[model samples]
Target: MSRWSSETSKKFILVFVFLFLLYGCATAPVTGRKQLILVDPQTEIKLGLQAYEEILKKEKLCNDPTINALVQRVGMRIAKASGKNYDWEFKVIDKPESINAFCLPGGKVFVYTGILPVAQNEAGLATVLAHEIAHAIARHGAERMSIAMVAAFGEVLAAELLDLNNSRTRELFMAAYGLGATVGLILPYSRKQEYEADTIGLYLMAKAGYDPREAIKFWERMRQAASGRRKIPEFLSTHPADGKRIQALKNLLPQVLPIYEKAEHKYGLGEKIPEPHCR
Candidate 1:
């Protein structure tokens, strides 16, 4: 009788989880992939704003007018292409050693000065900015957090289902769950998000009148920059392999090139980004 009750409880929990997931289903833009995001947009935007404030407080903003203007100009164009009514803002961070850029929820974007050389020109900059903007538009951060929340809920459910009374058994089960969830689920979802962003970004840049093909060149330069560095294997890394990303971009060009050609005002490469003067 006890065994039957335990089995019944497990089945009930599974059904409840499935129903909950269905209630939280969302479709990603551009790619139209179904997502199970349990968080609301308002909450995500609020959290993003708080983090944005914290980051701005710690990072030095670039005072160079040219760099600031360039970032804003490119960022706004991409934001407009996204068609999301986010309160978009772009700023340049004065980090010469960090070749990184990111967009927080609600369209807050930051570009590090170090990446400008690799970006080379307006089109290359568009490639980078568009990709980051796509992440925000897709609410990837919120989705990731929701995934973590679900994983935590699963752990709690497992404990109840198994009736893990022994402390050692509970510890081992938690350890295994954490490893399995991270490697098998979370990491793969992260890489999928990266790929989805790349696909969406190509369309956005093309629509914004920047050449979509420039994305390939920019990534090639990135690959060259990291040529000698030790690379994390794709299965373990949060991002897809650079070579794979480049190939995926190549595959997508045929679809996005027409969007660029049809844009009312094509900038092609737009303007060359000047090298910053030594302070």
Candidate 2:
């Protein structure tokens, strides 16, 4: 009787997982990659808005007219090219030491001052902005969150079914599962997303009239900037190696160059970025 019950439980779990995956299946934009995103778009956007509001309240915003103008100019162009009807907003963060930029789900983009020098010119800035916008368009944040939720549920189910009565054994099992899932599933998916973003971003920048080749140069400069730092292995890190990213961008130039040429208003790198004097 107990064996029959166990078999029934196993079958039920399998059926539930199959249904869950089928219900949550979605395809990413541009790449057409299928995804398992259980989170709804409305909830994801609400979370993004809340996070954006909290971040803006905490971070010092750059008030320099020149910097603001540059960011808005580049960001809006990329946003327009994306064809996503997001409530786009762009702001420069006054963090001179943090070299980063990100876009929230609803198209809230924030660029740190430190990354501007690396961006150097308008096309380079467009590379950064377009990549971030691609992340939002692809719904990567919600996808990641859904992956985490599924992982957690799997862990709980495993614990219950395995009958891990010994505390130490249960701990070991959970730890192993966490490590395996992180190394095998989450990290690889993150790298894939980064590569996907690079692809979509290249298309976006070209469509928006920026030279797609500048992306390679920008990433090359980034590689130089990180020359002295200890490198994380590509397998372990969420982002791909800078060299790999540069190579990928180089490989993609052939496809995007035609798009750039056909763009209605070619900016050809536009204006050089000026140093911000935050008021």
Candidate 3:
């Protein structure tokens, strides 16, 4: 029947279009790894912006003028050297118990007050800002979301192929991608990506006139911070520890040392950052 043939042809065309879209993937900066990101950059940035606004609304901001100014100063320098064209904003959270820093996509950075004691000074804070900004410049969060989109797409395609009339499949797909812990815990970046961020971050910090070597010291302090940690929470579950991460950075120091030296020379030698120890 002509009508039956027309319907079959339409389905074929749809499948062809789906495959074409899948083939058009993008490469990650610095690492140059091919990624199957179904979502556009605009979509990813919108989500990041929304998430950032939600966090600021929920968290108590640090009221200290000096601390806020310091964070903003260092954050701006790093953002400039990141070579990324995005609306950037930095905030210092008043939370004293949680020692963490994060840079969400589209240049949203947050530094908890608790981490400042460990950072000790301006250069130390620069180290934290540099690493967090590296995550944004490298598009690590976007890459993770892209992976989730691909997984969800696969689930839908699989369900259709199986001829399964199940709403649970759609629900499960949402659950998998919706949970940040999903990729953070199980499927993380290739070791290559971790190393790439370190290398790229060092250069960014150096160009920003911060001592890149402080990153090494910062991680050492982080390792000491997590030494007695018994259990991993969903958030910490995704990131690698200070020891493995620091060692990798050390190995790449030879390549980045010149950048550090230039930064130190240009910025004038800064006082040595003091090491932190847990009581």
The list of candidate 2 runs beyond 4 A from truth reads: 1-23, 154-189, 229-241
By TM-score, rank the candidates, best first.
2, 1, 3
Worst 10 residues of 2 by lDDT: 174-183
Off by over 4 Å in 1: 1-23, 154-189, 229-241, 277-279
RMSD of each: 7.2, 7.2, 6.8
lDDT of 3 by residue, 7-104 (tens): 76566557546644853377756557676544446644665665676677778887777677667877787788777888988888776666777777
Clashing pairs in 2: none
The positional error of residue 169 in candidate 2, measured at the CA in angstroms, is: 28
lDDT score, residue 47, model 3? 59
Identify the superior model by lDDT, candidate 2 or candidate 3.
2
TM-score of 1: 0.78
Write the residue-wise lDDT of candidate 2 on 1-279 in tens digits.
598777776865784476466547888888999987755676557656765776788789999999999999999999999998989999998987666777877888889898898889999999989988898888877676566555655344432422324443233322222222212433233778889989999999999999999988888777665567585322224444466777888999999999999998999898999998887
lDDT of each: 0.73, 0.75, 0.62
Q: What are the runs in model 3 whose C-alpha is more than 4 Å off?
A: 1-24, 154-190, 229-237, 263-279
CA lDDT, candidate 2, residue 136: 83
